[model samples]
Structure formats: C-alpha cells, structure tokens
Target: MTTLSDLLSDPLPSGLGLSDRQWLVLSALPGMGARRLARLACECPVWPDGWLSRLPEQAASALRLWLDHPQRSPFGALFDGLDAWLTADPRNTLLHPDHPAWPALLAQLPDPPGVLWASGDLTALSLPTLAIVGSRRPSREGLHQAHRFGRELAERGWCVVSGLALGVDGAAQEAALNTRGRSIAVLGCGVDVIYPPRHATLYRRLLDEGGLLLSEHPPGTRARPAFFPRRNRIVTGVSLGVLVVEAAEKSGSLVSARLAIEQNRELFALPGSLNNPQARGCLNLIREGAVLTTCVDDILDELGHWAETPGTRSAAPAVPGSDDDDPMLGWLSDVPTPLDALVTLTGQDVTACQLQLLELELEGLATQAAGGWIRLPR
Candidate 1:
C-alpha cells in the first residue's frame, strides 16, 4: 500500500522511466500542464530520461530564470512546503495519476490536472457527479431553479459538483447538502483556502458532512483570473453533465458550458424569461443544441444512459383539508422565496399573501429561511 510518505519518496525504474515523485515534481512547477508534458513526450519519446528530467531552461510552462536559475532551483523548497501542508491535516491528500484514488473522469480530460490537493471524501469523486453552475448575481427565479435542480438531482443519488462561488454555485451545492447528498467543490484556489471568504461556513460544512474540496493548485495558492477558467474545466470535465441554471451572454458560467460541449459531456440548461439577461447564455446554448431542461426528470431521462442517477425521495403529499386551503402552494418550494417574489408569483396583494404564508407556517407547510420563506419538503 502506498502511503503519504512514500508518495514522493519513490524513485524511477530505469533511465527512461518516470517515478510517481517525478510526476509530482513536474506538477508543482508553475505553468506546467499535461499538454506541455505531451509536447515533451513527442520530442523525447522516452521523456525525463534525458532533457526532461527537471525544469528545463526553455519550455512553454517553465520560468527558467525565476525558479530554475542555473545556480539554484526552487524544487526542493517547494516540496518541503508541500510536504508540510500535507502533514498538517490527516484528511489532506495529494493525488496523482499513479494513485488508485484518482478520478478516472479527470484523466480523460484534454489536459488533466497532473495533481489534485483534496480534503474530505475522495470516494465521492467516483460517484455519479453532476456539475451545477451559473452567474454570481442571479434572479430570484434563477436561485429557485438552482436550488430545486440541485436538491432533486441529489435526491436521486447524484453527487453535485460546483465552484462554491457566491451565487448559483453556492445555492445549488447548499441545497444538495441539505438533502444529505454528497457534493464536490472544485476550487480555483487551494482546497484549504476558501476563495470567497463568505462561503467559510459552507466550506466547513462540506468537509464535516462528507463532502470534498478539490484543487489543482497546492495549498496557499491564491485565487486569480486565470485559475478560474482552469477550475471551470474541472467542474465540467469531472461531471457526467453540466447544468447552467442562469448565465448572462458573457459570463464565467458560459466558459464551463463551452468546455462541457467541447468535451462532449452532456450540457443542460434551465430556460428563463426571454427578457432576462442572465438567461441569454442558456438560451444560446439550447439554440446551439444543448439540452433544454425544465425539470429534474428531463436531465435524468436524457443522461440516464451515461450518468448514474439512482436515488429516490418520497414526495410530501399536501395536507388533506385546510378547509380554507390557499392557492399559494404552487408558488412555494424548499428554496426560500421572498415574500415580495411570492406576491408577484401568486398575483396576490401583500396582506393576503402574508396571511396565507402565516397559515401555511402554522400548518407546518412552510418555514422561514434567510431570504424569506421555504416550503417544507414533502
């Protein structure tokens, strides 16, 4: 059995062979990626055996003068830091392709991350995963859509995957976790470093509740613009499919959608109002042949052949007789719906809406959430 200590201690087989440590060493290099390794392989069919052994003086993903100066290399110091980071926590894991725990889906990516710094359950990476993503500032309807999709998908035993950002990503992942389902957070920064800071509680919940945080960046690496696109690829690549709840014409979520299409992974999007700017991306995607999703079953039915969605939820039946039963049940959901939004949705005056909500709350049919109110799941 390979242990953490043996991870980087192992040596290469022969002159032309590569060791797992060599793989980690190469991965730690800045700008280094699978494509660069591929290019090197073409030149030296037996790589690292000769010119590719360490950081080269000239390469697409090398900083020859900065870190690989002729006098000294930062490789040893970097490994020392990484080893310290690994030892800091028992849950911390640095996974390479050689590790049996590596996600097989990631290996099929065009340029897979050579290493991942992860925490929590690694086994969740093997489960049927669904990527849920969208704009940072979405409409109430968009938020509701994300929550419903995530909850419903998770109820079916699918592990929800997302970036853990401020909006739809957070809403969806939180909803999935609320269902007591597994989830994976693919971070642009390190797994230990929470990007938004606002999601601190969510981050902690993820680990405590058997969720996982995955990162290509080593611990202490800060978030940057370039890192997100890389993160977006993993979100789509690791999942059986991606569902875009809402995204503007130009948004980071669209990047994931595009990557999903490029990878030939199933892409699903929830259609929003035609007037909504955030819906533009999903509409464009649907026009370009992405699946148009209206309900959880739409996704399950379409991806059933490829995705592993096997879970069930007993629907809560509406109460027998409120005698004065309100028509607002159609507007309520597990996701918080602001009173104003509910009023708009139900075409009712504020006073009447509040009264109905109070009645539902008294009947144990609704509960207050941070935003306003949410229907108790049946």
Candidate 2:
C-alpha cells in the first residue's frame, strides 16, 4: 500500500486530471457560480469556442485571455497557489461533478459547489450521511445529546456530517471519531485551513482517522462571516437529514435546518428543557414540523428507506433485548402511554427505557406519538 510519505514524493497526484484542471479554472472564472457551473458541467461544453459564447462577458474575456496567453492571465497566481496547495499534501484532492467519489446527493442542491476541495479519505462521501448541526455555544445537555446522537449515528453506519465548529458540531464529530466511525466536516473556509483554531486537534484527528474535510473555497482562504451561512447549505445538501441538537432562535444551525427542508431532507430537532435559552430554535423547529428527536432511532426510522448499506436499516448498536423480548413494548399500546408511565412499568431508568423504546421504534414495533410512546400494530 502507498504511504503518506510516498504520496508526498509523487509529482502528480490522482485528482488533477486534464478535465479536472479545466473545471478548476472555470471555477475560478469571474461571474461563474455554482448553478452556472453545474449547467456547463452537464453540457461538457467544448473549450474556447463553446464556452466563450455561454459565459458572461467578464468570464469569457478571462477565458479567452488565458487561452491566448497562458503565461500572463490574472488567474495564473491563483492557479499556482492551488497547484502548490494540492502538491503540498498527497491526501488533498479536488472534487468536481465528474469525480467518481463525488456525493450524488449534492447534484440535488439548488446551487451545488462548482468544485470541492477535500482532504482525507474520499470514500466517506459515498456513505449515507446525516448532518448534525446546532448551537456553537450549547448547554451541557446539548453537548451530551450531540455526543449521544453522533456516537449512535456513527455506530449505525451513518457518516456524521457537520461544520467542525465548536460546541454541538465538535461534540458530535468527536464522538463519531472516538467511536471509530466515519464523519465529514464541511467547512466555510479552505479545507486546509482549520477555523475556530480550538478545533485544531479535531481537525487533525478527522484526517488521521479516515474522516474527510471539504470546502468549496480554495485552499488558504480564511473563514468569513458570509461563507459560513453559505457553507451550511453544503452540510445539509449532502446528508439524508439534518438534526439540530440545540440552537438559539437565530442561529446558523437553523439556517441549515431550513436548507434541509428546502432540499427535502428530513429535519430532526432535539427537544430541550424550556428553561434552556439554546433550546428555543429547536422548539420552534419542532413546532414548524421538524421531527422532535430524542434518540438515534428516531432519525433512523425516518431515514431507513434511504439506507444504502446492507444491514444499516435494521442493525443498531444493540439494546438489552431482541425485538420481541423488549419489555418497553409490553407497557406501550396504540393509546400512547406517556413516557413516565412506561418508565414506571418497565422498572428501567428513564434513559434505559428511552433507549429500548427507540430500539422498538427502529424495528417498527413502537413509536412516540401524541401524549407519549405507543406500540405499533405488528
């Protein structure tokens, strides 16, 4: 197997093919945005002649100049910087619409990135993913829920997608990585530039542990206030769903939740205590029709039909009993047994009872409905 050092010594890496190089240049052209590039990508327009007619005047001029005079185009410096960034690390990859490992779900975005800069294993892109986003300054319970959801989702073969920011995003991703599962961090800045600075260790661990870092921006671009809201689209774009563990009334994660809804991806919100300020956004989302999620099974049940992996649909991290043996189902019925009542009857603590209920829900044997948990018709 080729090692990291071996990749570093190689002159030409795998992602810089002739077509990719052209796409990269187009991505840098003036007036070219994701929607336009996506259109052009589908046509695979011929160089110079075909492209010159379709591009905006400014972008056309730049392309013409580059075609005529390769040495002096304004993009030369930018291209050089990109090339240097790519060559500096063998793991760094450029993904375009044509890249084999590119996430097909991104094609559904209203404005998919024209090109993606990525580091670490690209294989993570192929896995069924869920975006776990919420408040950057969460309460302890918010962090705990993020950790729990992240760990369980990863354990269930779902790639946890997040922005790699602090608080909720960090907690979820770290949990996924710590559990030896897969994750992908979509960033507002360059894939190579670690933002938040505090997440430097998480950044390195993500790459080291076979996770992925992705950005639409070129390497070396600094994080900007505007870029993050735009970045939220990509985070939700590639996922089967988005889960807001916690958020204030006006938070970036809410933006992600909206994007998920627009993208037709399932939206989940972790309900928190009414007293917690950070829980307001989630509560609002729940009121707005986002599923009120308590456990990983809630997400799995909604997304199971979208499951691509062989066993992901039915297999979970294993609760105490098998499907038929789960005692929670005994106490639940179509009448919606309130959560406290189930806890009393099962003799298991609240957390354990919730887990079993979630497991039964995952198996389609029970569900949480109006008033409380209920057993489904077998």
Candidate 3:
C-alpha cells in the first residue's frame, strides 16, 4: 500500500531538475514578494530556462547590480542558501503549475504560489475543502464555535483548512483531528519547523493522521508577521469557502475571508455578541454581505446540492481522549472552585492541573466563573 510517508518520500521525475526547484525556491523567498518575482520571471529571459545555472554570466550581473546598489545583499544570500537547502531535502517535492494534483481552484487565483512544499497526503489537496480561520487571540465563545463547526464539517466530509495558529485556528484543527477527519495546516513558516513551538505535538499528529502540512516557503523559513497574509491567500484559495469564527478588527483571519470573496467562494460568519471585541471583524464581514452562519447546517445549505452528494463527507474518526483516559475532564468539579483549591483537590500536580483546565475549557466541559476558578457544565 502507498502510505502518505511513501508518497512524501518519492522524488519528482528527473525532468524536474535543480534549476526548476531553485527557481521555485527563489520565487518563494521572504522579501521576494510574489508580484516582483512574477515581473522578474516574465522580463528576465535568463530566469526561465536554467536561469540560476546561467547566473554567473547573465543573471548574476543584474542581481549584483540590484543587490550592491541597494545595500541588500542579505536577500541575495538568503536566495543562495535556499537553493542549497532545496537540494538537501529528499522529501521535498515542488508542485509546479502543470502538476495534475495542483488544485484547480488555486490556479484561478490572481497570484497563485509558484510552488507548494507538501508533507504527507498530497492526494488530499484534490478533496473538497473549506477554510476555517479566525483570531489568534480568540475569546472562549470564539474557540467553542470554531471547534463545533470544525468537528461538524469534518463529520460531513469536508477537509478543514487552517493556519495552525493558537486559539481559533488551533481549536478548529484539533476538532477535525479529534473527529478522525483529515485537515490541512498551511504554515507561514516551513513544514519541518513547527512555529509557536507549543503546537509541536499537534504538528506531528497531523502528519501521522494522513493530513497535510504545506508551505510555499522552503524549509528553515522562520515565521514572521508578513508571511501570514501571504499564507492566508493560500488558505482561502484552496478551499470551497472560508468561515470566520471570531476575529478582531485587525485579525489576520479577515485577510483569508477577503481572499475567499475575491476568489468568488462562499463565505460564512459566526455572529458573536456585539460587545465582544473579538466579534468585531465577523460583524464587519456580515455587514459587507458575507453569509451569517449560526450552525454547520447554514454552511452545508449554502454549499447547495453538493452538500447532499455521496462521498463528499469527511473521513474523521471518533474523537480521541473522550473516554475516562482524558485527564482534563477527570479533574473538573461540577461546582466552582478556586485554582489553588482545585489543585489540592485534584492532587495531580500544578502544571498538569493548569493544562487540564485549559483543555477542559477548550472541550466545552468547563466554564470560567467569578473569581479564579471554573466549574463543569451540568
């Protein structure tokens, strides 16, 4: 059987050579911005055909001229290292414009990535997908909505797409994974490097569960504020639509929603309390004509006939850690208790208790009350 690992290990055909991969890597450089690269690739004849190979003679002069006068040799050096790094990763496969597996939906975008670096189930890219994105600093309500919608959508056979950030993005991905459904994590950084370091476990689990981790950037690319908006475009471009769970006025999630609108994909917004600051972006989206969604059914209904079609539902399994083994819920009390008191009551150690509390809150098993602690929902 061809496992996802096997697929990832396989190399591209020999015809896909060093220069092509180098070009793709160069095209993905951090400050190299997509529009500028597109312009360069079009205008510089040397760039298209073994361009980097001919660099010493033709392109190097122009590149040096651009670099020296601008006093920006760092970007040029970064590009050189990118080429060397690309050569080292045997698992690295660059999906070109002609690859059959490239999602047709993405091709329609005005600025599609020149290449995609993928790990695990590349085939999943062809599946019908929906992007669920929201605030990195989401409220409790926002987190709940994201998980609920993610789980329900995964149960219905839609592959959840998310940026893998903390809060809403992490919640949605966790929900989909818990349901045994496939999800895709589009990173602002490289696939090999897990950002937010806390998500390292989730990142590894995603690989094992036949999900995918993708980036246009080469391995070793660090996460930066600027990389996110570019990453958002891919999230929106790849999906059938985008759902905004909760977002502040300045949140990156709105960027994905806007891209979805530009892509002409369906857009859904979860309405939140008007006073909650995190709800501001979603409200703005609704006012701008995005569909107001209260439940998963709202989204499925908007998908129209396709929602009812066979083989379109997600393949997620039953939620893990749902049984007695789940340490988080095991420690919760039906009545509110102070954090210090709860720690003594559970006798499970402080850090474990704190993590358990956070997990329980995420799973909707507990709610924060007045003072310092929480109580389980009756």
Candidate 4:
C-alpha cells in the first residue's frame, strides 16, 4: 500500500511550482475557501512564488483581514491540528487540484474542494460513476429496489457511488459489492471516522471490494449537520447521473437530485406510491420532468451509448419466486382487503405476509387504502 509519506516524498510537478509542504500550507491558510483560492491564483502575477514562503505585502494584508473576520477564522481553526494528524498516517493522502489523481469531474464544479484526503484505489475516481441517494429511513421495498438497481448497475460496469448512510445508500453499496463491482463512498466527514459508527465493518469491507472511500475534509473532522449539504454537491458533481430510490417530499436526498439537475447531469427517480410519504419526493420529481425509472433499463436507456459497455449491460436471469410468484399476492385483487382478513385467508406467517404485501404495494400490484391492502385497478 502506498503511504501518505511516499506520496508526499514524490517530487512536485514543474507546472504546479509548489512543494508538497507548501501545498499543505496553502490548504491550511485562513479564509482560503475554494472560491478565494481560485481568485488568488488568478490575481497573483508571479503565482505560487513567495506566496508560500513569504506572501506579498498586499496578499499578507488580505490574509490578515480574513483572519480577523469572525466567520472565516473559526472554520480555519477546524484544520488547526490537521497537518500533524495527516503527517502521522502513511495511508492518508491529501490531494490538491494540481495533483494528477485529483478527480477531473470535480474541477468542473463551481466550488471544488481545495484538498481531498483519500484511501483505497484513487484511480476509481477516473472511472465512469453514478450516484445513488435516497431517504435514510426508506421502506423495506425501497431498500430492495435500491439494492436491485445498484447490483444491476454494478454488474453492468458503472461504479455505484453513494453517501453510505443507512437505508437506500447502504443497500446500494452492499449490492454493488455483492456483484463484485466498484463503488465509491463520498463522506461528509473525514474518511477515518465513520459517521454512523455502526457501518464500521461495511467501511472496512469497501476497501478490498474494488471500492474507494473519499472525503474533501482532512482526517479527524467529525460529521456535522452543516457539512452534509456541502458534501452532497460532490456526490452529484462526481457522477454522470444521480439515482434517487425514495425520498420524502422534503428529504435530504432531494437536495442531491436538485444538485444533479443544476450540474446538468441526468436525474433518475424511481417511481413510488403516492401514498407512501417516502415516495412523494420522487413522484414530485417525476412531475417536474425527471426521468421516471421503473427498472434499471430506464436508466441505461437514457445513458445511451455510454452504457453500451459490456459492464453496463445486464444478462442475469431473473430470480424465481419474486412477488409475482406469490400465490397469496393474488388475493388482494383490486379492492382493498382488511389486514386481519387477508392474514386469516392466506394462512402465512404474519411477518412474511406483510413483507410480500409491502413489495406488492411498491410494485404497483397492490395499494393501501382504509388500513387494508388492495389490488390496483386493471
């Protein structure tokens, strides 16, 4: 495994004209957000000259003004101890915009990260990718749909990208891994600290299964509410498209879909029941002209030639005994049936019956009305 020390020891490119240490220093500077840094690069005449060792008096004054400002100073303090922490880990790599491995997709965004700390296969960033995002508390049917979509996409060749949160995100990554496909997780916090904590094992498994863990924040930054909306843009920015499995009318996943639209990337929404609050956002998105995705083909067809690659094609035989094969599923018919009555007539385990019912409902085979399951009208 290439260590951070090894990456730092490598000679800087002549075009960058900045030492590894100098790059780190620039990243640590106060008020040096992505936009500010880009402006500084443009305004400075002999760029990257004494900018590192000794700032020009005018630049130094500008830096002082930023440091004295209340808002920018505190955020800069977040990186106060990052340099030493990064130096301690051989595996931690901080990649700047000029770095060869920096993701080219991110550069096209208006506000790309100044630095990215990454682990696992950095080359995966160069591969064609898609982002799958949805509600953290998705229904069981939603999870199944996400997994199915993710697994199919992975088997076909596209790298499944997600936030690694619970529910749909977790299902997507797990499905991609199961199919021996590459996946990338873009974190809201540092890569070293798993935000949900419960997903520590999943995080470890990702490293070996052709998956990469990435973050713009340096190591040691804890997950925070404010960081996620900013983090979401990269999820959309890095991918060729974004797939939303299920989302509430005002869910965070909608933010990702909106960002994908703003980036002019394909936005695919899995159609869900209008009755399901979790599905309302997707229905709304479809109403707004986002592609209504019934299956993986809906997405692949939209990608057109890009998806013609062998990896993006699906050939797996459909599994037997899915919802369509369930005999009890036919009992509900077009009219809603009381839960207790259906349980009595079906004579199946309550949990198993409920699971099937949920799947049927999501597939548009059944509907919930007046506290009962009903078959959709013909």
Q: How many clashes in candidate 4?
A: 5
Instruction: Give the per-residue lDDT digits (tens) of candidate 4, residues 1-378.
Output: 111222222222112444444455555576566655544543332544445435546545544544466355433454555666667755556776555555545544556666777767765665567899998999989999999988988877878899889889989989988988888888999888887887887798787766888887777789998989988898887787899999999999999998988766789998887679999999999999899999888886776534454333343212234554666665654444444334335544333456677787787777666425567754
Alpha carbon lDDT at 327, candidate 4: 68
RMSD of each candidate relative to the true structure: 18.6, 14.4, 18.6, 19.8
TM-score of each candidate structure, all chains considered together: 0.71, 0.76, 0.65, 0.69
TM-score, structure 2 vs. true? 0.76
Clashes of each: 2, 0, 8, 5
Decreasing lDDT order of the candidates? 2, 1, 4, 3
Model 1 CA deviation exceeding 4 Å by range:
1-20, 38-72, 306-378
State each model's CA lDDT, in order.
0.72, 0.78, 0.68, 0.70
By TM-score, the better pick of 2 and 4 is 2
Show the lowest summed lDDT stretch of 10 residues, model 1.
1-10
Scored against the true structure, residue 3 in model 4 reaches a CA lDDT of 18
Better model by lDDT: candidate 1 vs candidate 2 = 2
lDDT tens digits, residues 224-326, model 1? 9889999988888778789999999998899999898776678999888899999999999999998999998888676643223323322322332443255
Better of 2 and 3 by lDDT: 2
- Per-residue C-alpha lDDT of model 3 across residues 232-267, encoded as one tens digit per residue: 888887787899999889987888888888767889
Best by TM-score: 2
Alpha-carbon runs more than 4 Å astray in model 2: 1-18, 42-44, 306-378
